[model samples]
Target: MAQSMSSPPPALAARGSQGIILKETSGSRLESTISGSECRVMEFSSDGCQLAWCDGKSVTVMDVPSGAVKYTISKPKTRCIQFSPLGSYLALWEPYAVTKDVPAGTPNLHVYNSSGELVTEYIQKKQQGWCPQWTEDEQVCARNVTNEVHCFSGGAPGLTCDNKLQIAGLTTYALSRGKLPYKIVVYVPGSKGAPCFVRMFAYPNLNASAIMASRSFYKSDTVSFSWNKKGSAVLVTTTTEVDKTGASYYGEQGLHYVSARGESNMVQLSKKGPIYDVDWNPNSEEFCVVYGFMPAKATIFNCKCDPVYDFGTGHRNMAKYNPHGNILCLAGFGNLRGNIDLWDRESLKPIKKLEASDSTQFEWCPDGVHFVTATTAPRLRVGNGYKVWHFCGTLVQCEDTPPKQELWEVKWRPFPAGTFPTPSTSSTAPPTTIEQPVQQEKKAAYRPPALRGKPYTYKLHEEEPPQRVGAAEEKEKDKLSKSAQKNKKKRESKLKSKEQEQVVITRGSKRGAEKDDALALAAQILRGNKDKVVDPVGSGKSDSEKKLKNLRKKLTQIEQLKQQQAEGKQLETNQIEKIKTEQSILEEIEKLTLS
Candidate 1:
């Protein structure tokens, strides 16, 4: 079927034995007809404005809606016609060899511009080979019997077929449809008949350096190979045949995964049934495979080759991933009824199913959300065309071709539109810098001598030291020197007095009498009677006993002063001086008593 953009209502052209029927896509009404017989192939331009068809030896290019022939090329033995992706050119080729009487090296392939002018012709080295194919990027390619692919650069006036590369034992090949441009995957039989391998080759050059070969397997005859939308992996289905004695078995089947770099996990389908079809999801990393015959099953597998979903118990005929790759369409003939099941790839569940007595082929729209199912008429009857439907099972429209005509094929015209969202660009913010205050070394704060033994406490606000002027600095230095000298003197005098008091206490007996004598000296110093104080002894007189009592009272007062100093309390300078004087007097009294 050919869909034309030039047609205001989105026209679809279906070929039948009578001719070609042009109908509106939104309705079943016919718009125009191009009368022809045995139309073998039809294709629409990239823009969907022009339609082209080949009837064996002749090809016709037409304005789809007007049903008027733009140009007719009478090329004998023309097998197929294809429009370039850019809609600027068409490729026509003959798959079979030329007749013996034809000129010695006649060209079997011809290239024509949109204006129907001959652009180039490809002369074959051999009499027969595959037809020429156009790559997604518009390069013309053909493979010869020698397993060598020849690429021709499409340009004005002609195509250059000078570039050629050999792929030994090439069985089949598929071009990647993903971001990796022009990556060609070719299957080649293994050396020594061990197994077959799938290898990827770079386009154009087809260099040995870029070739990645997959693992070898016994089933070298590949049924089909499909590439994921991301071009990360390829799904391959192969069949193996075994001969025992005089009997031949052909049931060994397998499904394998090959990475873009040609790595294989060597996973095989569990069932012994032959794999009929395999399709990769365009939007995800999963694929669906159809196998078995009696009660066929469609199984979906992730990239890891793990089964994720199963459509149980049906005679599966065909399964395909929608262009968006989010939906899987499964169709098969069962119980005399054709079943078309639409499945959501993400959910792994069925979204819709339509049953028709003769439905067979399922073709998805380029929009991805819609698809069409082609059904044949029952025994040369009418009503044999295609049913247009949304993924949700809603019938959009249906058009039946002329009666008693077989619908050869149905396909949506390829358009330059995307069903998936474009990747968003990352908007990263620039790094930021923070300013910090300049750090300065701080001097240890000054602490009073009385509080030096305790833990240092931090001050919320410390007063800055006064800055000294030129003359005032000298005066300040002198004052500090004098104060330091005075403090040293006081410290020395206090140490000496403590030593003398310790000596007096050591000389006396370890008794209350020594304590009393020191107390008496301290009291005399405190009362300003430094010379009257005397050391008490066992004189056996009442006056001596009274002196002892006075010494005890003064000793208690001296102990209280020491306690105050230990508590971090400051003692008056006079009191400190008085204590030092008492210590001196006590030492002298001890000597006099001893003598």
Candidate 2:
């Protein structure tokens, strides 16, 4: 309705039924609270703590961190209160009933500096709209009417209204961080007069809008939409109704889709009856959904609809992934037989399942190394005021405590670096020698598998190690070589000795033949049976005894020569095979290695 020039932000002042109200500081249980209702919403200002709040008919500012009043501005009944992007001024809105048939507009937005003075009343031109919400990042704020929606930027002049575009029943809009072309998906109606329209806006600040897709329903036929992890896709919930009776016919469905892929590809998710609420894993890629209603679980799923955990039925009251996306925590919903499971992404195995029975909200320490959840509710504190409980049996909470007036939306606040699940100390490298064939099987077969010929290969011939030689060792080796040479020579000599032994035997046998011939002569000379050489033993010595003794002596001579030759031969055949092997190996080395 009006516009004013810029001025310095006013010092917050406490007033009647109003007090310093500091909100949005995150924690399980808020460490801060409003000094009283009529003070300014409590904030840490450059000078001191400033608080501000609405008195239904006006807005007041105060410094409750110190007892000082800053300013006050009278306005139409205000519903919600917020500071500017730079926290320069105050903007107040007229309250709306969520179910009220009319939309949210003409809701005077007054920007006031620290002096309780009005700077502007930029009344949005669109008529009949629902929830009007600002992006948490302050980049955009959206307003929706029956089938029309418009989003505006503070930098743009005048109240820009867009009516050509459509959303279903204006269930509301979703805001997120990072770059955009924000997927400002709005729920508008389809051809059948039901609210199932989800449109993605290009510049959230303009009337230039394009229809992304529309969901269909006949009666009570509006749908609500939520963003997926990356804001690239949205999950739209719709109800189909009977045209004749104005009664909802078909049940509810949650269709998931990505804008890049187009909504036609939206996969139909299992209906958890009619979902009252649904939230996806913030780390997006790691998929998990939290739905309202008991016995309904935080079902983990891959991008495909297949569920990850076969332990299918467990409700994660609320869950979050550690910044690194390694560990995940599911809390709050479990029966008598369930565990609070912690998983390692590498192993995909539950490292720990705390049997923490009492379900309360939890927050990660700035370092993702430690996360805290409430097992049992706190008794000494305002048990009703907060849903905080002791962590893993310890009473310690966290660093940033919440303010009582603020509905605490606690995140680990991702320090971005340390807030991920701590990786265990580890190292991975191919070993020095992967000799274990079994292990080789498990490793990814690299470099195209070995030509599978035989289960056992001809033992891969490897080169032998070099022979070591120091002076003393070389001398010993030389001595050994000489000994081997000598033994070989002895073998040759022994071969000659064998020949000589045979000759001796041959000569001895010839002598026997001669003696037999001589015996025949003597027998003939004596003209009777007689011994050879009978005349030589003229005394009492018998010719037969003499012949026997001579025979023994000749046999002994031959026996002694044979024994010597056998012993000599044993010395010569000294492990000839071992020596031959060494020689062959050396020859091969000379051929291959030297060349």
Candidate 3:
């Protein structure tokens, strides 16, 4: 029932009609038992330090570790007891007989501090199925009855019923958690064929005038709502019938996004039919919805209700978002092999799928990296326990509930803060220095020539003489000639052996002696050795040489044409000069004759 991070094993306080027993889970042993009147209900505080129990007429608060009674209060008829989330106060409900002396509207619930001091009492008409609810921070307590919601706040004198809000048709409610300002979401059914409304009320003072109702949707009888992690927005899933059938009918469902300030937006989640569920991401940036009927599909959506991603999950039964992380776990009953898929919000994809057959419950550890999944099992069977798992689906531990005990609930304790070592802050003290061992530089090992990355250079063992350039060329030519002769002899021998030898057509032997010879002759020609053109048999003259000869002839022709053009230009210049002189002389004669 309750576990503490400070302790090695979890402490579970089990209560039955006989007595109350506090058992340690690490070892199958009872630590302590408070045996008296039949205990009706027992609950451990959020901090796991205190345990409270109520029998029909009296309430007892006991220290969990020492089994010591801390406080006890007795009433005429106590119905139930609930400890505040912060362990500061306890709320006990008692039903008083509605007689003539007692008015019709009688305050039956009482609030008391840890020291058993009476805090407050309210005149709420006790309902058959109504129970008091508290905000996550324990700053406000709310009691819902019919269409009215009563809220109380802790004050100087006692718990005061500060605000009471009345909606037309109240169905369900959810309280915001975390650091955001506390808000209460209440669902009000539509009146006279109108749409249902989701309303938000500020905590401590939920006045009727301050009700902020969200945009309404078509007539939906079943509505489920969940608050985002930071309480900035609330996600509402509504199922509305499409056809007016008396007995059985199909319906449509939609997911509505409403901000803390009552602004609303919605998207049709299932065109096929009503959506099964919707869960919000821990960061309040996105949420996921399970839609479709058979072979249901799961879709993740942003705050705007826009679809981010979707996957097919066969008949999804439940989907939950981790409170401390962005991982979403979806489980369905249709799959016998794989039933759970862990989706990562950052990646927008599933990171793991687990094959947990018939898993009905999932609880994430406070660390967020690990979770626990449990499956229902038949009595006296072995499959009833839970398995601790990392987010990757690896099993960390498996635990079985005590046989025949019928596990009511199992939860991982919230890890305590300040458990990690704090940094040292003694600045006045001398700083301690640790001397590290001096490491000697290691020389690299020698690598063989074959293993070295660079080409290995070897010293010549002996030197004969300084070679001339032509001498090296001559040696290469001699080697080529000898290799050619050897190839020719082999070809002749093959021909002689074969009586009728086919015409041998070779594209230069593999040794490539002909190619070497052509290269050598070209080298000589480029060096202006006109007499050394050694053309190999069966090969024509080198094309390179022919191209060189044609280039030279064209060059000569170009020079000759340039000389002829220059001579022609000189002749033309002389003729033009003579003509100009004659024209001037004729003009001088004409002028003299005219004068």
Candidate 4:
């Protein structure tokens, strides 16, 4: 049961029944046409210029300058297909029912990416009626349902704990959206009536395996998270949820100052009303936010320690911190006068205010380059046809030329500033050198091809060098060479010393021989022609001479002594034998008897 209608979509009804309002931009007008599906809202894009509308049957793509219809997309009728923020891809939010039998049950959510070519379908239940957002970096997609926001990481696969969020929020169901190019994610653990107060995780895909994470928490629900280029200052909106009787519980939605380093310095934006969102000035000095619903208001906090711009009160009023944070754009929404207001960063006074025909979602380019507004359909005077709406945001032709696009801040940088630098004269200056400065050496991110760095091991207990076979050769060589020259010299000195001893001994022998001969002559003189038997005077030489003579005459003397001793003994024996013969003859008779 689908109903087709010839009724043109309501000028303001961009989202059918759902009331989806597309944010404004400054680019060329989007292609628009009536579609066949009965009463549906959708936006279409071709070659980038988006033509969006609500409750329309079909969308037509056309050439920009010539207005030529390029292509048309027809389908089972989807909610919307939007050009991704970067313009390289398209994001389609397709909602289909589980079955006609049940209406309140979970519905299947499908996403068609990269120009309707690839689609990934996922079912998100438990917390129903959710609208998800694609993060600017395409790293994650988020959905907002009831009081909590569900975000799914794009790189993750399978059902993991981190893959889902049951973010508890007890505040008013209003969510103010803000994004910083470098910012990731924040988590606040809410307990009961208190606005979610827990750790806010802030890393890009924590290794998918959940090995590590960079997270911090705030004890509140904030609508806006603004970033300073240095990541030092982020403006956070504080909200205080109040009950029906106006009894305030959850959150003191105060403006907070946080260093990108994750230091929380809270600044209460308003003590009573819920400060929807907070944004920092491009210069990082101040921040402003929109609050007070019936009478939308804006307020600014100047310096970290001070209050600068305080635009105390107004309704349907909005404040935008530009991409660069240099300028703050203020626009008022609601009755009386349809006007857009701008404010200077230094002067709190209004510099310029343009009567905006319609809608209030706009911003300065990321470069602080241009002003983009939502341009409503052209003014018409035929038959109460004032119902024309501004499509997607309009591209405000910049009054003051913006910074070059080349200087645009990209979301991520592959190489560090230390590794590469943009062409700047200051960069060429030689870096200062410090003596004995402690430097942390960086390890190689990737392992070397050849090295595995296995466990330390001993090479099978090598034999001691002292007992090795090769040691023998070295030992022999060492022995031969050990102090060779010095030892040879010592040997020569020792041989000389021994020669001196031998010389002394030989000389002593010669002297003894001479003394012995002299002693013999002395004996001859001492005897002197003895007729009266003077005998050889001391036939033995003087004691000293005898000692010398015997020492010299050793072997010959010994032989002569033995011969003399034998001759004397033989003579005595002959005498005894003769005497014994006489006795024996007489004794012969006696001997015979004794026998």
**Residue-wise lDDT of candidate 4 within 1-595, one digit each (tens)?**
2111211221121322222322222222232333232434444432224443323444333333354555454444455555544433444344555667776545344444434444544554432233345445545555544344444566222233233433344222211122442333344545655444322333343222431222333444444455554444555554544444353454445555555454555564443455555565645666666665434556665555344445645443566754444446666533323455555454444544455443333434322323444322222111111112111122222111112201101011011112221111111112222222133444844545564585434443232211112445567667776688578879999999999999999998778766656644443343242232222234354554444333324323333445666778443565445444533432442333233
Can you tell me which runs of candidate 3 are displaced by over 4 Å? Answer: 1-42, 53-60, 65-67, 72-81, 93-108, 121-137, 145-147, 155-160, 166-175, 178-181, 201-213, 239-254, 333-338, 375-383, 401-405, 415-595
TM-score of each: 0.60, 0.46, 0.56, 0.43
The whole-model lDDT of each prediction reads: 0.63, 0.44, 0.61, 0.41
TM-score for candidate 3, residues paired by index: 0.56
What value of lDDT does candidate 4 attain over all alpha carbons? Answer: 0.41
Clashing pairs in 3: 107-122, 107-123, 296-315
Candidate 3: residue 413 Cα off by (Å): 2.5
Weakest lDDT window of 10 consecutive positions for candidate 4: 405-414
Choose 1 or 3, whichever is better by lDDT: 1
Runs off by more than 4 Å, candidate 4: 1-77, 94-96, 100-107, 125-183, 192-195, 204-253, 257-259, 270-277, 282-285, 290-298, 302-305, 312-316, 321-327, 335-340, 346-349, 353-595
Clashing pairs in 1: 5-48, 282-325
| Model 2 clashing-pair count | 39
- Quick one: ranking by TM-score, best first? 1, 3, 2, 4
For residues 94-132, what per-residue lDDT tens digits would candidate 3 score against the true structure? 765577776575767787888889877765454443456
